[model samples]
Target chain A: MKREKVVVEKIVETFGLTKRYGRQTVVDRLDLTVSQGEIFGFLGPNGAGKTTTLLMLLGLTEPTSGYAQVLGLDPRRWPLEVKSSVGYLAENMGVYGDLTAYQSLAFIGDLNHINGLSQAIYEALDLVGLSEVAHKKTGQFSRGMRQRLGLAEVLIKNPKLVFLDEPTLGLDPDGIATMLELIERLPAEKGLTVVLSSHLLHLVSRVAHRVAILDRGRLMAVGPLEELAAHAGVSADLEQVYRYFFKNHSQVLSEATR
Target chain B: MKAIIRKELADHFGSTRFMLLMSLVFMISFLGVFLAGQGIREVLAGGGGYLLRDRTFLLLFTAPGAFMPLTAIMALFGPLVGLILGFDAINRERNQGTLSKILAQPVYRDEVILGKYLAGLITIGVLLTALFLILTGLGMTGVGLVPTIGELARLAIFWLMSVVYLGFWLGLAILASIAFRSVATSALAAAVVWILLGFFVPVLGQTAAAALTPLEDPARPRAEELAAYDHVSRLFSLASPPALFGEAAVIMLDPTHRGSEQALRLSTMSRLDRLLLNRFQGVLSVAQSLILAIPDLLVLIAFSLATFLGSYLVFVKQEVRSA
Candidate 1:
């Protein structure tokens, strides 16, 4: 007897989404889907339009053309609704420098209209393992501490979909392991669907069920880690598969130009 | 929203910025009062001489001028506070990658903007009110001078006018914050705009009006010339809050005195002698107060709305990630 495949419940869908700044196209025409209860990793190199793409999906930035829907609502027209259902952690993940860890969490909880905000704040602090220093001002916090606080802020609301952009960028090895554990636990523990972007293929492969590789403003490749590795004719190492794909594509483009 | 406002007030009061602002306010107000008191004391000690009499009137007129230096200081820093408070209102969250986190909950963008603006306004309102109370307290304690009902009425109008004045700068700051990506750039942009609107534009307006309608003979008895001067002066003065505030304060302080020879001549005539003194019997009605107040209110509202709407539009169009 075969276990049933979880039906893909689309949480986010985009059709021909494009974004341009001045004369430069940042996110070219692209179609994408994020299913409910999946940790989807958006893998990209520097300036690969990962952040820009996520911003358009989050309705924080408008697309030049095409449509985006988050939780079945057009992002442009119903941004507030889309935002309400989605949790986003950007690249920098700045906490209110002046606010204490506890105070920052409380403020964000209040903004989100979260009930039992004090308790929620404490719980979030504990989850991030910053409970001991929750009262310390974020300005005094280390980069890893700020990153944890940023994650705590997102978790405070218990969002349905979480967007984490380089969430563990500045964390130490221990912090990274803690964050990875937290991310892995989220989908099962809270029924959350996460869409995180990172250049770290190993990290992405460990947690994400499905992955989309972005190069420049275009989609380079996408699939499950194992399938993508097999397709690249490499060992079951996501990093090696990613490098191989990119290397071959660039080599092909160079040869074609010659 | 209320929670946001409470948090903002807490943050403002907790920050060193509020302490600096309070100190500045106290310093300016104390200086104004001390100067006024010294000038008055000197005139009284001079024993009713002609110069003393003229100086008493000048001292009263000059009370409004004290607000000028204070207004300049406020204009310089007001936008700085607005930019600092609001520039990162959305972008910092994006940069910190918390924008999505906050938005994922049940909050609206309008609520965020409204909450932030409300917090800023509340902080400013509390600061201004505290300053007003301090001034009133000092006046009562130091000089044994309790403002009369009429004077109190004028002070209220002056306080009300300040909201508009501050609102203009606040709106500009918000616009700058939305337009720029960095807080430093926003602060600089707002300061430049402040200097232009608060100082340069008003001076330009005065110069243009002066060139258009040069000052006529001060000794002239021509009513039309005097009316043109008054109209032009009032119109030019409307370009700056300090000028508008000064005019409003003057009207409130001495509603019957319109800087006319008639008011001066009437000052010399006794109440019973007024019947005999037909030359000094030009009655200054309450109608003049209404006329003066109406324009001041309209101009303040118009400028406040322009700045507010401009800021709102910019905020609405702003990309969260840009900041």
Candidate 2:
């Protein structure tokens, strides 16, 4: 029964997805699957095509080759439908400074045609611990406060799946902890499936159920920490597991050249 | 789309940038019109033949003020409002990272551009309507004259033309915003275009016309040479949006304005012909003014639609990824 559920609950599936810009390939032949209710981490270095892949999945960008199914719909054919069902928290996403937190959420709600907007705004604000600052203009918000509001924006959409790109990029330690805790609780509390893309492995390790490490537009490894560690013949820690794959890649390159 | 339009309207009306610029335009235009009204009052008191002129009330716009006429002020500065409102419309959203967020919603991509364009048009319409109302009120009280229904109709058409003219500039600004990545670059581009079209074009046209239509006699030029000079200069001036607007507006506001052909004939008239010329060449009907102005009006409309369509095409085809 558990096996059947796992097989039936894939929320994001991409087959050999490839994106190229001019002569440079940004995301290369990536085959990935994200199951429902899981915190799937996309771990990579800068320029590893993590953001490109996310954009392609959201249909904001067209892939050069391959296919992706998001929420049982091909994003290319029905981008509006795919977008409506998904919440995306962009890196460095900004709210209108002139609008209060509640107003910005209301604007988003109206655009998405969401009903009971006030109720949704209040609930989302409370969940993200921004209820007290709901009336405050976003321009005056601290970085941590803004990051929490971004999460609230995602929550207000009430999406089945959410994509968070570098959600804790500029936050302090306290802010990071609060954000991670919020992310960790989302699946259980709201029945959401999250795909988090970030370069900070330690931060992602705390919340991600399974992770895919990518390098130079290629997927290096994908599995739970224990499974990745066993493959690398190292202890089950994300740092060591990550190093094992990248370090092996260099050795393989040297041997082939030799 | 409606939501975007509402948000944009609120942003435009509430922003200090827009308010400051709008108020500056209002104050200057008010000062110009007030000066014009004072002059008109003096003329009214003198009881000159101006009273015999049809649509004499419109002189408040056409009459020379302390410096420039109200029409000249609008011709020079009205484009600034449209340019300022739109120069940073798209790039600012990208820089702030809000564009991607908005696109991620269910909203169609076209809605973003269409909504913004409509919001800008609405704001321009409201502000221009308010300005005309205030100016008309001043004219009625300060000049102690009530406009006839025909004059009001002419004024209404002039107001619509001004909106369309400013909209052309707005569309150009939006095009610049989409073509350039930085807000400063787009702003500079729009300003440069405005300068080229508004200030430099007329001077350039004069120089070009003189070169193209050289006179045989500098002191006592022949009728044909003068006619050719006027034709060539007018042709060159038509290249400018402001010039086009000025031509159409002058005809619309002044009912006595026959087409350019009559103006040319009058300039070439002998002294006896001038004295024998009928004193009662009655003012043109409103229908006559519309017919005379149709060519300029059509070109102005085309200019507006082409520019807006250019921006729409560029915006819809643009990649949403922010650098």
lDDT of all predictions, in order shown? 0.69, 0.87
Poorest 10 consecutive residues of model 2 chain A by lDDT? A249-258
Tell me the tens digit of each residue's lDDT in model 2 across A15-80.
999999998999989888899999999999999999999988999889999989999889999999
Count clashing residue pairs in model 1: 7
Off by over 4 Å in 2: A1-7, A250-258, B265-281
Q: What share of the true interface contacts does each candidate keep?
A: 0.64, 0.85
lDDT of 2 by residue, B195-293 (tens): 999989888888877898888888988888888887887887777898888888888888888767678888789988866775746688888898888
Q: Note the chain A TM-score of all models in turn.
A: 0.92, 0.94
- Superposed by TM-score, candidate 2 places the C-alpha of residue B323 at a distance from the truth, in angstroms, of 3.2
Chain B vs. true chain B: TM-score per candidate: 0.74, 0.93
In the predicted model 1, the residue pairs found to clash are: A84-B104, A88-B100, A88-B101, A90-B97, A93-B96, A93-B97, A94-B96
